[model samples]
Target: MTLALRLGKTLAELAGHQAPMTARELIFWMAFDQLSPISDRRSDVHAAQIATAVYQSQGAKVAFDDVLIDWSGEEEGVAEDDDALETLFAALSQS
Candidate 1:
């Protein structure tokens, strides 16, 4: 599946219902939270590998550098909203 489709499925699974947000939006939030300020090269590389698999599943081109650049840029204004994050986490925890 595409990254978007995979993320959407994950979001649906986590939420226990249809996600209210789009896959791109959810990925933006996750990239903002998870990809930015990545302190460990090992983990970063692992994430890139997973991203590549997802992209390839949908026959999409893998461009880790470009994706990382975009994700880094997205992190600028994407502050961690505790309330929203908490809600999402709560849903995930229940699943």
Candidate 2:
């Protein structure tokens, strides 16, 4: 698929997921994904992080796919190192 189209689709999927995204996860899927931004543009990483924090705090006030997800991600945020991220991505592939 074309890069922009693929990125758009990925963004849509990100919007549909129930979990609260950590900054690193958001940055990964937005900026470093195989489908990346055009050279003239960049993902709105800061704004996305702020928005995620808002959605997480609003909890019951927001719903995704008609389902209310109370995904409290206390210690479940994406890992900080490459090996852990590799493990996380491997686990995600099985989901």
Candidate 3:
């Protein structure tokens, strides 16, 4: 996968997190956050390798692409209007 793919995947994961993320997650996320507008530089490659290594240390024999790209086939949650509920009290707030 490309660096853009990596950054996007990492960002999506971070977005869904509601609780505190572990140091490993933070490290991994930050590593891929680089924009690298000039294409993959030497430092970026090193960062990618480090990110992959972090996963490998946890016993996952995954590649750089695997760690970076989202493997979940599930699509991002789309907001659907609940007309039935909206019709009701604007309904009970989940919060």
By lDDT, the best candidate is 1
**1-95 per-residue lDDT for model 1 (tens digits):** 24434364555456576657677866766675564432465467677878878887999977776344343445655777899999999999999
TM-scores of the models, in the order given: 0.35, 0.24, 0.27
lDDT of each: 0.64, 0.54, 0.59
Worst 10 residues of 3 by lDDT: 32-41
- Better candidate by lDDT, 1 or 3: 1
Q: What is the lDDT of residue 25 in candidate 2?
A: 57
TM-score of 2: 0.24
How would you encode candidate 2's per-residue C-alpha lDDT over 1-95 as one tens digit per residue?
24524565544345676555567656765556446554332334444555666786888454332232224544455556898889999999999
Q: Candidate 1 has what TM-score?
A: 0.35
Candidate 1, superposed: residue stretches over 4 Å from native: 1-39, 55-74
Order the candidate numbers by TM-score, best to worst. 1, 3, 2
